[model samples]
Every structure is written in structure tokens, then in C-alpha cells.
Target: MKPAAFDYHRPDSVEEAVSLLAELGEDAKILAGGQSLVPMLSLRLAFFDHLIDISRLDELKGIERRGDALWIGAGTTDATVGADRQVSAAVPLLTRVTPFVGHFQIRNRGTFGGSIAHADPAAEYPTVALTLDAVMEAVSPRGRREIAAADFFTGLWETALEPDEVLTGVRFPLSNSRSGFGVHEFARRHGDFAIAGSVVAVRLEEDRVSHCAIGLMGLGSTPRRAAAAEAAVLGMPLGELDPKQIGELAMSGLDDVPADLQGSASYRARVGAVMTARAWTDAVAEAGGEATHA
Candidate 1:
């Protein structure tokens, strides 16, 4: 199947893109990398009257560090991000997860901002954003605003972005020396969407957990922070932590786990727990201590 016939507009600047969206209203769709949108269009799962291509917008293309955060342009490709030295040094969780997004070909054309805007529940970027408290910046005809990662994702394929807004970029906080990150997921193949996944970032203060953030994907309508699990490990001695108990607590509060042909809700929940445990354990080791539990 092919997409419905639609008008295509290539905008050289973000302002131009926003203007097009404002004028076209709900009929306009922004095209970044088109990794996700192109497939959807090919299947006729989505249709738009016009496609506002912003792939060439110079305003949305760069990677820089500001203060304590790394600002990644919305137009930056996943392949570039995964291989960037700055990304690896600043936010290792992103570095660890990006390779799992898709095969090399897909990553070459997939935009970082595009993934966040699409808000696929199983996408690695969204889960990383949620775990690291990344901030998304958007511009519109009205004005510009920053949306916290926690508040950006509303549901499956839904986000806080308005119809007339363009996502400019995202800002991820740099991890300090005391922090360690880990990401783990289960997929049918190397590049397949995760059936269940977990990302953990831990900051240790003298062998005790000082701060922790856990994000779970493929188990809910949107990638969600595992607040319950984070709270369970905070301030606890790393050696005293039980991976099994922590994993269970991490997902215990989730009641909306999605079920599908890939697996049942209960099965996802179980796998999610195991992944959370592995992620937490790996994170703890990376933070400087050997994990005592399996």
C-alpha cells in the first residue's frame, strides 16, 4: 500500500516549518528523518494533506553542550548520536541504548527528535529521555516552550506537541562521576522492538544509593518512570539490595501493562521485572561496586 496523495513542502528553516503547520493546521505533518512516518505512510496507517519537510532546516541541526546539559538537535541522526564522543561521555545510557533502536540502515536515517515526537512506547530514546529527565524544546507561531520528559509523553503515539509546533531539540543532563547507567531489553532479533525493556541511572554516595531513576518501556501506553522501584533502592547500601525484590517493586504499581500477540500482560510484567533487575544490577556495578545479587 502507498500513502494517500499529499502536497509536500520543504522548509529551509524552522520558522518556515512552523508557519506552514500553522497555516495548514491539522492537515500538516512535520517530516524529520521519516523513519517511522514513511513506513506508516506506506501502510496507509496515517494520512496527511501536506508534509512539511524540515530535514534541511539548519536551525535544527547540531550537537552542543550548554552549562550542564547536552543539547541534541531534533534533526540529528541516531547513528551520529550513538557514535558521538560527547554523548558517550555525558549520557552513557543513551550510548548504550541507541544501538538497540534498529539496524544500521534505520539508525542512519532516524532522527532523535523524530523518535521522541512519535512517542512510540517501545522506542529506546523515549525510555532514555524519561530516565534522564531530558527536556524537549518546541517552537510555534505563538511562542516557544520547554516540556519536561515526564510531561511530554501523553500516550501511545501522542505527545504534548501542538499541531502548529515543531520540536526544536532535546536537552539531556550530563551524568556526574558518581553516576552510572545501564539499559537492557528483550527482543526477538537484534534490531527488533523490545518486548520489554528497562533503563537505570544510579548515583552513589559512599557505597549508598543517593539518587536513582528507572524507566520501563513496552509495558504501558507510554514509557514510564519506575518511581516505586527507585524509591525502594534510594539510600540503601548497594550490598544490601536484592535485585529480585527491587525488580518486583519497580513494576508492582503498574496496572496498565499492554498485552498483545507478542506476549500477555502477565508475561510482559514478568519479563519487565527481570529486565529491571538486570539493569539495576548493571548500573550498580557501573557506579563502582560489585552487585552482590543476581
Candidate 2:
């Protein structure tokens, strides 16, 4: 199916794009990498009368260190992000998870902000952002505002972004020396959308687990944090930190898991638990602690 006819506008700058969006209101949509949007449009799954092309806007295309966080421009492509040395060093989880975003061709054109704004629960970027508590920065005629990752995603393909607002960049906090990150997802095949997945960051304090963050994907309406599971493992001694039990606790409190053609709710929960456990083990080991049932 072909996308319905629409007006295309190429704006010179982000301010111009924002102005176009504000002026066009509900009729317009921002066109960044077009990896996701183009597919939806081609399938006739979504319709917008006007597409404001901001793909070449220089203002929205850079990666830089901003204080304690790394700032990634909204228009920056996944390929660029995956290849960046600073991103790999400062935010290892993001780099490690990038290979799962899609094929290299797709990653070549899929924008970092586009994936986040698309708000796909199963996508690697959203889970990473949520796991790191990355802050989303947006602009509008009103001015610039920052939204915490927790508050950014509202529901399936939905976000807190207003109609006239444009996502400018995302700020991910830098990892500490004591922290280690890992990601695991259970996809049926390589590069496929995961049925269940987990991204974890763990910080160790001597012989105990000092802090842990767990983000589960493809198991809820939105990428979710395993807060209860994280809390269960906190202060656990290295010898007592069992990844399998951590996995179970991660699945225990999930009430809104989806059941569909991919798998039943119970099946997905099991996968989620396994993924979480594997990721936990990786994270714990990297954090200089060994996880074992003993």
C-alpha cells in the first residue's frame, strides 16, 4: 500500500521545523531518519497531511559530552551512535544494545531520537534510555523543556511530547567506574524483535550489591523497570546473589504483559525472567562481583 498523498516541507533549521509544526498542528509530522515512519506510512498504518523534513538539520546532528551526561542529537542516526567512541565508553549499554536495533542498513538511517520518540516497547533504544534514566530534551514555541525518561513514555506508540514540540536530543548519564552494564534479549532469530529482553546496570560496594537497575522489554505496554526485582537484590552479598532468583522476581510483579501471536503471557514471562537472569549475571560479574546460588 502506498502512503496517502501529503505535503512535504523541508525546513532550514530546528526553529523553522518547530514553527512549521506549531503552524500545521495536527496535520504535520516531523520526518527525521524515516526508518520507522516511512514503513508505517507505506503500509497506510498512519496518516499525516504534512511531513516536515528535518533530516538534514545541522542543529539536530551531533554527539557531545554535556557535564555528567552525554548529549545525543535527535537527528543522529543509529549507525553514528553505534560507532561513536564516546558513546561506547561513556554508555556501554547503549553501544552493546545497538546491534539489536535492526540490520546495519536500517541502523544506518534509523535516528536515535526517532526510535525513542516512536516509543516501541520492544526496541533496544527505549529500554536503554529508560534503564539509564536518560532525559529527553524538547523544544517548542513555548521554549525548551526536559522530560525524565520515567515520565517520557506514556503508552504504546505514545509519549508526553505535545503536538508542537520537537525532540531535540537525549541526555544519558555517564557510567561510574564501579558500575557495569549488560543487555540480553530472547528473540527467535538474530536481529528479530525480542519476545523478551532485559538491560541491566549494576554497581558493587565491596562484597555487596550496592545498586541495580533492570529494564525489561517486550513484556509490557512500555519498556519497564524491574523496580521490585532490583529492590530484592539490593545489599545482597556476592555469594548470595542468584541470577535465577533475580529473574523470577523480575517477572513476579509484571501484571500487564501482553499475549499475542509471538507467545502467551506465561511464555513471555518465562523468557523475560531468563533474559533478566542472564543479564544480571553479566552485570554482576562486570561489577567485580560473582553471582551464584551458593
Candidate 3:
């Protein structure tokens, strides 16, 4: 199937792009890398009368370290982000997860902002953004504002972004020396979506857990943090902690996990538990803490 007919407007600037969006209302859509949108259009799954092309907007492309967080422009490609030394140093979780975001061909054309805006619950970028507490920046006629990753994603493929707002960039907070991050997913094939996955970040001091974050993918309606599991380990000595237990706790909090052809909800919970355990062991090791039972 081919996409429905639509008017294409290539905006010279973000200002012009937003202005067009304001005028076109519900009939308009922003076309960044078009990695996700183009396919949906081709399949006739979505319809938009106007496409505001902002792929060439220089204002939306770059990678740099801000005061503390690493700022990634909305238009930055997955390949560029994966290869950037600064991103690797500041947010290793992102670098580690990039390769799993489909094949290299898709990454070459997929934009960071587009993925976040798409907000697939099982996607690596959204899960990492949630785990690392990244901040999203957007622009619209009402002016610019920052949205915390926690409040950014609202539901299935939906976000807090207003129709007229264009995501400008995202900022991932820099990790400290004591911090370590790990992401693990179980896909059937090399580049397929995960059946279940977990992302873990840890900070250690004096053989005790000081800070921790655990994110779950392919197991819920939205990218979710293992809040109960994180709470269980805070300030707990490494000797008394079991990575397996942590993984179990991660699954204990889930309620709306999806059940489909890939697996039943119970099956997904088990996979999620194992993935969480694996990620926990790696994260603890990297943070200089020992997972004694591992």
C-alpha cells in the first residue's frame, strides 16, 4: 500500500515549521528522519494532510555536553549517537543499547527525537531515557519548556507533547565515576524487538548500593521503572543482596504486561526477571560492587 496524498512543506527554520503546524492544526505532521513515520504512512496506518519537513533544520542537529547533562539534538541519528565519544562517556547505557534498535540501516536514518516522540514501550531509547532521567525540550507558539523523562511519556506511542510542539533536543544527565549502567534484552533474532528486557544503573560507595535505577521493556504499556526493586536495594550492603531476588522484585510490581504471540504475560514476566538479574549483576560489577550470589 502507498501513503495517502499529502502536501509537503520543507521549512527553512523551526520557527517556520511551528508556524505551519499552528496553521495546519490536526492536519499537519513533523517529518524528521521519517524512519518511523514513513513506514506507517506507507502501510496506511496513519494519515496526515500536511508534512512539515524539518530534516534540514540546522538548529536541531548536534551533540555536546552542557553544564552537566549531554545535550543531543532531536535530529541526531542513532549511528552518530552510538559513535560519539562524549555520549559514550556521559551515558554509556545509551551507547550500549543503540545497536539493538533495529539493523544498522534503520539507525542510519532514525532520529533520536523521532524515537522518543514515537515512544514505543519496548524501544531501547525510551527505556534508557527513562532510566537515566533524561530531559526533553520542545518549542511551540507558547514558548519553550522542559519535560522530565518521567512525565514525558504518557501512554502507548503517546507523549505529553502538544500537537503544535516540536521536540528540539534531549539531555541525558552525566554519570559519576562510581556509577555503572547495563541494558539486556531477549529478542528472537539479532535485530528483532525484545521479548523482554531490563536496563539497570547502579552507584556504589563502601560496598553498599548508594543509587540505583531499573527500567523494564517489552513488559508493560509504557517504559517502566522497577520502582519496588530499586527501593529494595537502596543503602543495602552488597553481601546481603541477591541479584535474582532483585529481578523477581522487578517483576512483582508489573500489572499491565502485554500478552501476545511472542509469549504469555507469565512467560514475559519470567524473561523479564532473568534479564533484570543479568543486568543487575553486570551493573553492580561495573560499579565496583560485588553481586555475591552471581
Candidate 4:
């Protein structure tokens, strides 16, 4: 199927792009790498009267570092960041999960901002952002605003971003030697959307857990932090771990999960618990934290 005819405008700068979006309002869809939007357009799932192409806006491309966090431009390709020295050293989780996203060709064109804006619960960035407590910067004709990743995604394919607002970039804090990050997901095939997944970020000090974040995807209406699991693991030494207790805490954290054609709520909950446990194991291994249950 072909998309309906639309007017296209290529903006050279972020200001110009914001102006176009403001003028066109809801009728305009900002084109990033088109990895996600193009398909929707082709299937007529998304209809727009105008396309404000920011793909060429040079201001929105590339990576930068500010203090403790790495600022990734909205237009940066997933493939590029996956191989970047700054990104690899600063936040290896992005590099670790980039290969799991779509394919090489799609990653070459897929923009980080596009993934965040799409707000697909099954996608990697949203989970990563939430797990890392990243910040999203959005610019509009009115002004610029920064939103926490937790507050960015409101629901399925929905976000706190206004129609006229475009995400400029995302800022994720750097991982240090004391930090451990792990991403795990199960899919029928490589690059396919995850059936269930978990991302874990932990800060360990002298073999004791200081801080922990557990983000789950593909089993709920939206990405959510596993607060109960985090609380259970916090201050606990990884060496004296109880897998059953950990699994129960993780399961208890997910009070409400959505049922889908892929699986029932029970099935998803089971997968989620397994993934969460595996993620914890991997994260502890990476952190050099002692293994207790072996």
C-alpha cells in the first residue's frame, strides 16, 4: 500500500524545523530516519498532510559529552552510536543493545530520537532510557523543555511531547567501573520485537549493591521500573543471593500486565521473571560482584 500524497519540507536547522512544525501543527509529521514512521505511512496506519523532514538538519546529528552524561543528538544513527568510542566508554548499554535493534541497514538510518518518539514498549531505547534515568530534551516554537525519561512515555505510542514539539536529544549518564549494566530480551528471531525483556543497572560499592534499577518491557502497557525488585536487591550482596526471593520480588513488582495475542498475562509474567533473573546474573557478573547462589 502507498501513502497518501503529502507536502514535504526539508529543514536545514532545528529552528527552521520547529517553525515548520509550528506552522503545520498536527498535520505535519517530522521525519527522522523513517525506520519506524515510513512503514506506518506505507501501510496507511499514519496519515499526514505534510512531512517536515528534519533528517537533513545538521544541528540534530552526532554525539557530545557534557560533564557526567553523554548527549546523543536526536538524529544520531543507532549504528554510529553503537560503534562510537564515547558512547562505548560512557554508556556500553547502548552499544550492547544496538545490534539487537532491527538490522544493520535499519540501524544505519534509524535515529535514536525516532525510537524514543515512537514510544514502542517493545523497543530498546525506551527501556534503556527508563533504566538509566535519562533525560529527554524537546524544543518547540514556544521554548525548550527537558523531561525525565520516566515521564516521557505516557502510554502506547503516546508521549508527553506536544504535537509541535520535537525531541532534540537524549542525555544518559555515563557508566563507571562500579556500575553494571545488562540487557536481555527473548524474541523468536534476531532483530524481531522482544516477547519479554529486562534491563538492569546496578551500582556496587565494595561488593555491596548501592543502587539498582530494573526496567521491564514487552509485557506491560508501558515500560515500567521494577521498584519492588530494586528494593529487594538494594544493599544486598550479590554473593548471598536467593534466586527464588529475587524472582518473587520481581514478579510482585508487576502488579498489572497487559494481555496480548502473543501471550497471556501469566505467560508474560513468567517470561519477565526469568528474564529479570538472568539480567541480574549478567549484571552481577559484569560488576565483578561475588556470586552467592552458585
RMSD of each: 0.7, 1.0, 0.8, 1.4
My TM-score estimates for the predictions, one after another, are 0.99, 0.98, 0.98, 0.96
For candidate 2, write residues 1-51 as lDDT tens digits: 899999999999999999999999999999989999999999999999999
Question: In every candidate, how many clashes are there?
Answer: 0, 0, 0, 1
> Candidate 4, residues 1-294: lDDT per residue as tens digits?
999999999987888888998899889999999999999999999999999888877778889899889999999888888899999899888888898899999999999999989999889888899889999999998899999998999999899999889999999998977887778888878999888888888789888899899888886777878888898778987767765456557778565677777787888888888888877777877888854553
For 1-294, candidate 3 gives per-residue lDDT tens digits of 899999999999999999999999999999998988999999999999999999888899999989988999999999999999999998999999999999999999899999999999999999999998999999999999999999999999999999999999999989998887888999899888889999999999998999999999999878999999999999999999998999999999688899999999999999999999999999999998776798
Count clashing residue pairs in model 2.
0
Q: Please tell me which model should have the higher TM-score, number 1 or number 2.
A: 1
Q: Rank the candidates by TM-score, best first.
A: 1, 3, 2, 4
Where does candidate 4 stray beyond 4 Å?
253-255
Q: lDDT of each prediction vs. the true structure?
A: 0.92, 0.92, 0.93, 0.86
In candidate 4, clashing pairs total 1
**How big is the positional error of residue 253 in model 1, measured in Å on the Cα after superposition?**
1.2
